[model samples]
Target chain A: MSTLLECKGLFKSYSGRPALKNVNLAIESGHIVGLLGPNGSGKTTLIKLINGLLTPTQGELYINQNPVGVESKKIVSYLPDHTYLDMNLKVRDIISYFMDFYEDFDEKKAYDMLSKLRINPGDKLNTMSKGTKEKVQLILVMSRRAKLYVLDEPIAGVDPAARDYILDIILSNYEEDATILISTHLIADIENILDQVIFLKHGEISLISSVDDIRSGQGKSVDALFREVFRC
Target chain B: MLGKYMKHEFKETGKLMIPLNLVILVFTLLGMVMLGSRLLSTPAMALIGIASLTLYILTLFAIFIVVYVYFTVRFYKTMYQSQGYLTHTLPLSTGSIVNTKVFVSLFWVTVTVVFTTLSIIALVYTAMGQEWGKMAVDSDISFLKELLFSFLLPCFSLTILGCLEQLLMIYASLAIGQLFRQYRVLASIGTFFVFYIALQILGTLTMFFTQFFSMDRLFHISENISGDSFIPFYRQLFSVSTIEVIVFCIVFYILCYWLTDKKLNLE
Candidate 1:
């Protein structure tokens, strides 16, 4: 029950307009948590704040009880909403770079993941299709034995087949002791895999419940409750 | 990390630089050819020497432009666009990246200037049939040093300033400009204009203060007011001193690094 991430009264804005407002969240290790929200509901912002990509304007965020900074960044594997990989690098070169910089990067696991996806290490990123590129990025991030994995819209811009493959890769590669916070609007697709779900609406938590609790206590699936709660 | 950073810097820089170096090589070769053709038919050896020297000066100018533009563009794109986000975000300290880039820039500038000078000297010696050394001795070896310093010193100082200015202006420009996605380019230009005006105002203020107070400290102009009128204006270059230049460079680097490290939106 050790906390992997903690956010208290987190606030953020762009150009004086609020993106996130006094949002509080806490996640513990060894759980697959689905972060369900409508578009522009600050799911990505919260993930970004946790990853130290965007500094919070107000309040505090901690990763593994440490403040978010270079140290936190080192232990957090962040898969950004967009591709962060340089398009000019070969897959092998990119792997070497991560292996050189990150202490926790698992080269063997990365290679195995790539082989499973049939992605050649010699292939240039620019030459790969967008879906394949996302797969490569996912492989690289998940190859790390990070304390927490922050995946922002990993399945957004891909084919259904590719999405399933990505999910499978994520499930297989994630360390058993680590936590994962996956932010997406596609709740039905991810509900089966997620042990816990956090529903966000207009930058506030609408619901946070375990899948078993949702089914047993309310006699309803997490997806049905999500649709009911977030109905327009 | 710095070694890897410089390796990529050199690799990417060489892509544009090799062509510029070749252009300087061809200019030197052509100047040599022209001098050789003239020397074959003329008895006026001094005139030939003079003509060769003029061509050498022109080649030096060409060298300066090629290297300056190549480094400017190469450094900007690589440092800002490709590797900058990674560099700024990494656990490494800020001073390391700045120092590495400054050294790399100075390295390329020195290489370009020295190689171009050597190429010109080689061409001159080849065209003049071993009399090049005699010409140098006759013209006083001091004259060659003077010629080099005269041609390169101002350009060198300006090149350093140009690099620092671009580094500062571009970072601030990008930071402010990136706030607006729709008119980012226009905003960048506006920022540059504002920064340029601010720099000019600073320069004017410095001039006014120096003229009012540093007349004695800068010029020792009490010798002869009328005779040393030009000295006050001309010696500002010498009076500002190298320490001032170094301090300004440090300040500019710190400002650039701070803005880049804090405000970067790696979109």
Candidate 2:
């Protein structure tokens, strides 16, 4: 498999404090990789760097061997942890906005997902419940035919059922050749869907291995290993 | 992509601006009717007329506030707030984004100015009637033309340039403020005051330099000129101010674009 993302000595700092220290990583295509870390472990910072939202203080990152720019943005569908959408816009309006900007955006797929959730396209975003808003955001992100989908805490604020639904949507969406990098602290919820997991601790990658490898070698699930490794 | 960005911006801002313009139009028309009609001349109707006049004034004030606040808030919220997540991720350069906003802001500012000017003209015409026409014709045609070319045209252009400068200044301040790890809004406000003071100092220096270097020459030329040649004098004054405004605008635009492009911290 070809590498979809590569980070070379990536480091990010804010206000004289390091958010991400020197970290090198390579993610290949066709696998779901869990970026598991506790709060402020630099998971979101890494995702933000990948999406070109935040600039790195040192080193470089690349998607498809290209630095983050318009070309890389074209292929990366990002769902931020917060609601980045305008609340005044209707669901259809937001979808059309995505369609206008992203050539890879699949409008029919987005609408179909919305319909499956019984969400009216005419409904304004501010009127929707928090879970519904998150679903809409996820639907929009998933509806893109992007090469990499960076989801930052996708199931953080939702209930267990909604989490499953979101994960299911994520699982069903995207091409098999594409990669999904899910950043979350809810390891147990997403552990089953991940093929490989990268444990990030205090701005560095603590471990990166396949779930089967961890299962056979460590005689435990990925979540159990994460708990042991990140025990407070 | 810039076109797409502009289209989205227009769609979002138009929802508020179009209705505000309509309200201004409605109030203008109502005020015209109240002032022109003879039915409101009675003592009892005087109270109604006063209320109408007050409401009209309030509406006009509201238009100014709305236009100014809308552009400021939109720039801050869309590019720096949570919405920045969506904005910065788009496959477009920071220049394109800022350009779209500046263009949209110019459009709304022009609309507001035009609306206000037309409303004032309508109100004057409604009150003064044929006297306004007489005053227009009684004025020297050549002198009026020169006044328009020198004074009014430059003033209009200066106003437009000033609007662009203000928007860019706000954008630059917001960009600078984003560097702060906390209290970004406070930082933005503080930056604005700093920029304001810098602008004032620049203004004072420009005035001092212009007067020190050219005031004597300008006065000598004015003394040699014939009847009512103040148009050239005003034009020269406005030209210098216009250049100053344009320079400030370019500097602010560069500051805003550079910071937004490189030092973006959308935390």
Candidate 3:
């Protein structure tokens, strides 16, 4: 698979403090990669950098050989940790809004997903519960046939049952060649689906290996290694 | 992409702006009906009429204020707040994003100001009845007035330029504010006041310096301080006020765009 994303010596600093330090990484197409890290390990910061939502304080980052920019953003679908949509807008309006900007956005697919979720298209986002809103956001992101999907903390703020539903939807969605980089602290729940896991610790990558390799060589599950590595 | 951005921008803002305009239209209609009819001749109706008149004036002022506040807040929310996560991720250039905002803001500001001015005129016409015609016939200024040069044209240009500058200024402040690690909203508000006060002080100093230079003052042409001084005075107006406003607009616009495009630090 081709390299879908590349970050070279990436550094992000807030004031004088570093969030991501000298991180060199590449993500290939057609895999679900788990970016496993503890809190403040810079997963969201890295995701934001990839999405062109934040500029790098130093070094280079690219999507499909192009720098983070309008061109790069075209093929990257980002689901922020927060509820990032306008709550005042109707779900239908937001779907149309997605349709308006993204050429790859599937309007029919969006509506279909909304209907299946028993979500009313005419309902304003603010009226929905947070779980419903997150589902709507997931539907919107997955409806796009983007080259790379970067979901930041997709299951962080949800109940266990909803987490399974979200995970199921994420697994079923997307094309064969598309890659997904899911950032989460929850390991055991997602390690089953992950082809590769990158363990980040304190603004640095502690490990980057295939889950199978870790299981065979390390004599432990990816979750077990994550616990041992990040056992502060 | 610019078109799509503008379309969404319009859709987002139109929800509030459209109803606000409708209220103005409905109020103007009501005002015309009440003022043009004998209803206000009754004591209670006259008292109610007075209240409605006050309300209409307040509505006119509120239109401008609401448009400014709503557009500014919308810009902040969408471009800098959590919603910014979605916005900055769009497959669109920063140029498109910022330009779309600039045009939508300009469109709303111009529309509200125009509507307010026209509504005020309509109310005045209704209030005056035949007095408008009488005044038009009696006034020397009406005939002698170069409508294009002195009154209508300049007012229209000034209104547009003024609104553009204000909108861009607020946008620039919001853009600058997002650079801070915390208290971004408070920072944005502070930035706006800093820009405002600096501009005010600079303007006063410019006036002082211009007077020091014995340049033809801004008031000279409008005040009719001298005879047949029209062309020279307007030349100075265009050179001075028009250029000054345009410079501020361009500066604020560029500051807003460049900072948003290059220096964005969305938390």
Q: Which candidate is the best by DockQ?
A: 2
CA-only RMSD, every prediction: 5.2, 2.1, 2.5
Deviation from native of the Cα of residue B167 in model 1, angstroms: 2.6
lDDT of each: 0.73, 0.89, 0.87
Query: Which run of 10 residues does model 3 chain A get worst, by summed lDDT?
Result: A167-176
Between the candidate structures 1 and 3, which one is better when assessed by lDDT?
A: 3
Instruction: Give the TM-score comparing model 3 with the true structure, all chains together.
Output: 0.93
List of clashing residue pairs for candidate 1: none
- What DockQ does each prediction reach against the true complex? 0.28, 0.87, 0.85
- Candidate 2 versus the native: TM-score? 0.95
* Residue runs of model 2 more than 4 Å from their true location after superposition: B38-55, B217-228
Docking quality level of the chain pair in candidate 3: high
Models ranked on TM-score: 2, 3, 1
Q: What proportion of the real contacts between chains A and B does each prediction keep?
A: 0.05, 0.89, 0.93
lDDT string for model 1 (B1-267, tens) is: 667756755765676667777777776777677666765465677676677677667767876776656654544444454344344444444456656666676666666766676786677587776586777778766656655565356555655555555555555565566555366657767976887787678767766776776667545555545423533354464445434445555656666566545544433
Interface RMSD of 2: 0.8
